[model samples]
Target: MEGKEQNRQEGIPLQFCKNKTKRRDKSFNVYIKTFGCQMNKYDSEILEGLLKTRGFTLTPHIEYADIALFNTCSVREHAERRVYGQVNMLSPQICSLGKSKRGDNYPNKRIIGVIGCMAQAHKEKIFDRLPQVDLVCGPQNLYNIPDYLEDIAKNNKRILAVDRRERPVDRENFSFRNKRRYLTAYVTIMEGCNNFCSYCIVPFVRGREVSRPPSLIIKEIEVLIKKGAKEVTLLGQNVNSYGRDFNNGYNFIQLLKDIDKMHELRRLRFITSHPKDASDEMFIAMSKLPTVCESLHLPIQSGSDKILKSMNRKYTREDYLRKVDILRKLIPEVSLTTDIIVGFPNETDEDFAETIDIMKRVQFDTAYIFKYSPRPYTQAARLEDNVPKKVKEERHQELLRLQKNITLSNNKKLINRKVGVLVESADEKGDYLIGRSRTDKVVIFKGPKELIGKIVEVRIIDASLANLKGEWIRL
Candidate 1:
């Protein structure tokens, strides 16, 4: 099961926020380092726009940049720790660059900032220990770029713009810069999560779900498609919960049907669906919609009903299998993937076996297995995380080993089959191009650069547990 990004938005920049300075000025280079899900990746794109509008030039190398910003995550403690280590490693280098400037042509002083979920979760604490950090802003305050900078200049060495009480909705006018390199684009349908699962800090850090207007969503998709995007992945913490709180009763399934009805778009996909909200309507739309990918990344965190109850996942083991049943019945060719947490507090041997049993029953095409980690303020943090760290480590490996054979068996069945792949980039051997089939399987094949941005047929000749090796079949 591939774990999907829990919180993010497709960032469009605001022309209204443009600063008076040279474009890509050598004096000011802003480099954004992103970690975590697709949402964070998309947010980096928006961050790029916000910075570009402010006359800051983007830099590929972090060492060369005057502003090193991290759009980070808080799903796992390790994710946050990596950010801390990175900032710590660069603090001295940033200071050195600031001091070593020879003249006006050398460069300006550097500032380190942490934005997005990790910023919301740690707030000033991320800056407290690392005094070199100039700014910390949450996902909702991304549009407050100018003011956050203003405060920093006014004798504020460290400033955090996280509002735990009231989520500041600083909406920006949408204008994308340096578009993602692919026919596929992740267009966010909503921001935040309401689930607040016991072991997760997403809801607290990212806030409740707020969907973009269906019109805005449609407009965004249309723009991406016009910009040579052939496929779109509707990203959200819980995508199936789309339109639940909106005035328009247009649900995720309805959105699929609407998008499918559109001409020119070759493929469509959505991710990280909660098991509960993947309703009959969404499944039905998936079954009927021509462009919707046959793959669904529905996360079933735990298999045992007792463990699920503890995790506050809202679905039992049987309930999850029912979803697979519905999807298989509706679209027999549909590929299924899932996320499994191998160890959670109080999980017994029986619970662990039940999870393995569930895996055997469903035979997910792929699965992402993670050992549970206690996140601060999450409900599970209060519970006794009595599962031994070593035991958790062992269980995680067991799940991974099992999943390897399961995935390989599934891939083996596809050898010599012809599938449509949307070429995104080249494979490990640059001579061949790499793309994903509508079933969301990664396929590699030889093709000209012109083959990109268009769906091409590939004949699978070789198979690996992770991806399919194939050759392009010209139509």
Candidate 2:
């Protein structure tokens, strides 16, 4: 541990402090703009928590911030492009601020940084792309942000802290700065990915899988519940493989069971379960755990066996179907959602048809469909992107159209049925409240503002492809 700390310190060099006398007495405010995934959002919360402890305040407005950070994603090309655009928009303003006169209200040296997957994936290249950025740190190095900022403030130096070493999860660093707007919160039980799915950049950027101790996870959720968080979603690249790195016999199922025993937690959820790791014991736990939500987001990138093989997903279509069948048998009310990629490299017409056929058979409650975009450092990137752009768009549209009808039909089945919804917030018009059912369906109904953090019963009156319209039955 001592050697590791020494090496970490050596990796991030501290230059001679020149502007130490110019340090201000005022508390610095940080503005974090997050993009992509629940994991990134949770990361931002941790960032704010750490900054707050170092006498920095969290500000929602970018213009009022002394430090502007972009917590970015590298999942898709568009996500990376969007972050670049955001950096472009903020760079000139930040540069202009640095050139302006120093005053009591305005600091002459405002720092800009990029943190998260994009920072890890791109590394030093981000400096070339966004010349005004003072820091580029990865997910693993986020805990060091306070130190990096302090160095920048004292020495006026650029810092890049993208350490890929396997670090143990620090439970204390996972704290949130303030109470959440809603009752639901996301708790990342594990970090990184071991599965090198051909289309995924997670393994490359997030490093290997490491699960937090089960006791730590339970303790975090318990604390959140005490702070009025009623719903918690466990996040991971592949949540089903959570305890594979440990030898104490605790796994994802046991973790869920432990969390389920928390009396104050109304809902327990998890995401991105691999079909190959969907064990029968897990299904049994889901069935028996009272607080566990009856919803699963199992991603089957492609329904075609050939494409699945090429993607190295390790599960056959039959294997996926069997798991789904088992889940449905155990929990009849379970809502199933999946992810689909339209144009993987060398995907044939029959492969595309198989995806559509599986969609028809499963009638997924919802599906996140995407046109394939090859990511750097992935196996798929080396393969020719054979599918034409026009063809990819057509396939994408076809799947969307098919799923729209299926979702509408599935939602229509709930018409006039009573369901319990955990009200989250008021809708835009303020005439109604919006909440989510246990199955994760968005339901809107007329209610008072007091219903925001409470669960109430509602009768489904109408349905659309995306949401359910309901009448409030009672709180």
Candidate 3:
């Protein structure tokens, strides 16, 4: 036990299999194709870290990989369809990979695993549909992937692990810190959601809300900052409801306050706040904390009170507006972004008009407009998808047009203004550095390549619906 602890403290990763042969220690490349939100991206990072513990190397090229994993999302029908399409296209290529010198399939055959929410949703059905898949592990059982691969390598049987009872909280030790892009990191403070919004499949697939210990979260952020992370975004299905599961009085506001005390952390952010849980104290924390950005991503799925109630949102249109009013009053320069769903079941022309009215009233900086699609096992799926397809398309387009105009107008207002942008990355051509302002607006500017991870003031020279072009002004 002393030796093992010393090895861990020395940064020497122990293999999952202790009695492994010398052949297993050789580096085997893994390619992960992630299709989903930020949470899924973070999950892929964890998956990569776990695979590394088993002596596996990450490869960017799919053709050279010994194993291929798809971290999927089941949020909408469109997202699922995309995963299927990509899997089919890569099937033959994945199968042809990892041909050993001896030409034996055992221990050397290229492995394909379907992990994450989609794996939980469909389970072993993916194996029946896609015979190429060797493993199907869900979000809850992600920690078992490395062990499952070991078993498959020894014995050629396919593995299916979708257990929901176990919470892999200890997986925090394997948070994959990206050395190349240390400007920002995602720290998932909690997992799962109790609020089963009628249109959402999150609660069903992810299970109930389970918040991580605040001590673990703080330690993770400290490590990230020490490793050159300038910013960290606290992630959860609904971030504002962070510590309700705990007996302690530690809530989202307190969590923010504690994280703000980290002097090395330059910026802080969070996402997907539910309107019902958005509180004055949370807004106040955002205003008081110098590290916290003046931006909020409160998702308002619909503007009509009728649709909101039907979707089990638990917040009326007026309630949402009231919260928005409070937020604006507290953080006058807050950049509000949101998610809007159009053409929900039985939605009338009036209901969609109400959505338009809310958009006009709020003038959000950006809105992710998604057409309503019934997810499997969701309450919305049980109802007759009454809205016509053509009408849904029309309304989706109308919302996009309106939001595009509003976003352009908002950007135009920033012209000639100087904003501090945390440089995130460079354009592919290396002609410009791309970064985001405190408001979370993307700003592209010409600067020294050394400015990749530092915050610099950029003067806004041009504006567009997508991004703002700026000139680096060393003030």
In model 1, pairs of residues that clash are: 1-338, 1-366, 1-367, 1-368
**TM-score (all chains, Cα) for each model:** 0.89, 0.91, 0.92
lDDT, candidates in the order shown: 0.77, 0.83, 0.83
A best-first ranking of the candidates according to their TM-score comes to 3, 2, 1
Candidate 3 residues lying further than 4 Å off, grouped into runs, are 1-26, 92-109, 168-170, 174-179
For residues 288-317, what per-residue lDDT tens digits would candidate 2 score against the true structure?
A: 999999999988888899999999999999
Superposed Cα RMSD, model 1:
7.1
Q: Give one digit per residue, the lDDT tens place, for model 1 in 48-90.
A: 7766777667788886675688889999877888988998887
Error of 1 at 151 (Å): 5.0
Best by TM-score: 3
- For residue 331, what is the lDDT in candidate 1? 92
Range of the 10 consecutive residues with the lowest summed lDDT in candidate 3: 1-10
TM-score of 1: 0.89
Model 3, residue 126: what's the lDDT? Answer: 83
- Over 211-305, each residue of candidate 3 has an lDDT whose tens digit, in order, gives 88899899988888877899999999999889999977789999999999999899999987999999888888888999999999988889999
After TM-score superposition, what is the CA distance of residue 302 in candidate 2 from its true location, in Å?
0.6
Worst 10 residues of 1 by lDDT: 1-10
